[model samples]
Target: MAESKPSAPRFAYKGSRLKPLRAFCQVARLGSVSRAAEALYLSQPAVTLQLQALERELGVRLFERSGRRLAPTREGQLLYDMARPLVEGLDGLATNFREQVRGLDAGELNVAAGSSTILYLLPGIVEAFRERHPDVRLTLHNVTGAGGLDLLRSDAVDLAVGSMLDVPADLGYTPVYRFEPMLITPPDHPLAQKRELELADLSPYGLILPPKRLTTYRLVDLVFQQNRVPYTVALEVGGWEVIKQYVAMGLGISIVTAICLTDADRQRLAARSLARWFPPRSYGVVMRKGKFLSAQARAFVELIQPERSAPRDAYASGPSER
Candidate 1:
């Protein structure tokens, strides 16, 4: 009888093995199997199976279930620390390699920003980018300031463009545009007639401000508090456009960044420059420290700030305050 052929190993090495590793890293980062599934665009059972397969292959319990959350074990943390960068590198390899060869002819770029930044800041930059690289896919994530930072930290976005009064330690911000604060009032309001205004001048009017959770509202509150002026919030709303509309309707005046002001707004409402009272706000590109920017993302950043591309330094050197 002929010798029996040796059977193949039960878990042979294949490109598909990377799937479980990717799923594991996502679950480790997000701390939830469902979230990892959503992020990976897989079913919950599929992700669960991948985790189980990974655990079996490694012969270790990677995570312990704590109610609805999955907490990584020591081995899991060790694997994650080793696997995350590898996974990120592998996942980005194609894009990076293409960018290296084609030099921005094609690739995908994801950017995140708050509503105001998307509405007021990115139109011209995006138009120029799209015209320049029509083949490259562009996705804009409309997120809040905190959400944008989260996306940046997780490498979900190539970069973020928005205002930042306080940047975190691990992020870099380069100011690309500056806009002064402006006080907006109905055409017939009392403060509209004043040639010059002060913080005390805004105290009595009912302020139609964005919710206190927003940076703009916080800045306004801080400025007033510093100046020892009392202000009233008649309504807490979202969006600069809505506040502008309400101000035009004589609901209450608002303090808003001048970036949103347009000729139509000038016609409908009285506007006063608040540069003397409040410092000019800067809108800029925010990125994670040490992130490797693909050519497509670099090209977009250059479009926004022609003076510079993504910095090569480990982190931004000094305070980003303007």
Candidate 2:
């Protein structure tokens, strides 16, 4: 019999599986073949071929078109939920390995935080981290809650530090600090003079608040709605500093978190605790569930939570409150 060419093995090598898996993960994550191709530095057709091969090999449809985006099918999501971390770990193998050998002397740390957290909470922490590992590069992304969550989901940032009222299933949150809710007004405002602050007392003055889409505005609305107290917003603004400034200028009163309240702020703005009505806001580390934290990332997390470094399967164990 003529020597039969052994049927080419399905995959060229065991390692070849990593490539398709990586391609699948990128497409699933970004929901766009072109974007995934750009991220992977592969041609659009190359990415499409890899995804097609993967589906064929696996005998399952991986994606469905939804509007302009590629939405993962149930099987695709199941695969993605399992494959992303593996691909991420492998993609970062070089960096992680180098960090292990060098002991955090180099490598980059990316963190996402809101402006308030960046300004108030992280200055001391960032200073401490830089002093210890000056050689390590640190990049801080100033983003709002939704923006930060998107970064976390995409693994563009190693971790996020912020307040969390609701923890998603795919992510873990460990609250390290708590700040009381405060109502602020101009120093001479009548509401500031009251010894006892009532939720209903501030109904008369229009509230200056962040956009209604933000957690603070929604939380304030929730509390008021629950109490059946009607309120109005005089100005919908963004940023704690701007809101405080507006409140100081006697434009309107605002409900704010105490994290943004400084001595200078107290000098310019009258602030009273509204904690009795609103739950204390908790600020902490937010990370994707199955993420493989690089050494540089772990070192930063340790600085934030001195007692314990991030747990490997933190989301599985549920959110921890410190």
Question: Candidate 2's C-alpha lDDT?
Answer: 0.81
Window of ten residues with lowest summed lDDT in model 1 = 313-322
User: What lDDT tens digits, residue by residue, belong to model 1 across residues 176-248?
Assistant: 7667677899988989887666789888889998887888889888888888889999999998899889999
Mind sharing the TM-score for model 1? Answer: 0.66
Q: Whole-model Cα lDDT per candidate?
A: 0.81, 0.81
The residue ranges of model 1 lying beyond 4 angstroms of the native Cα positions read 1-99, 306-322
The alpha-carbon deviation from the true structure for residue 107 of candidate 2, after best TM-score superposition, in angstroms, is 1.1
- The sequence of per-residue lDDT tens digits that candidate 2 reaches over residues 1-322 is 8998866447532337888899899888899999999998989998888888888777799999999999999999999999988988888989878767575888788999888778867777888889888998999998976899999999899999987888989999888866677778898999978887778899999999988777888898999999999999999988888998988888999888776766677579877777689887777889999998887788788887523322222111211111
Model 2: weakest 10-residue lDDT segment is 313-322
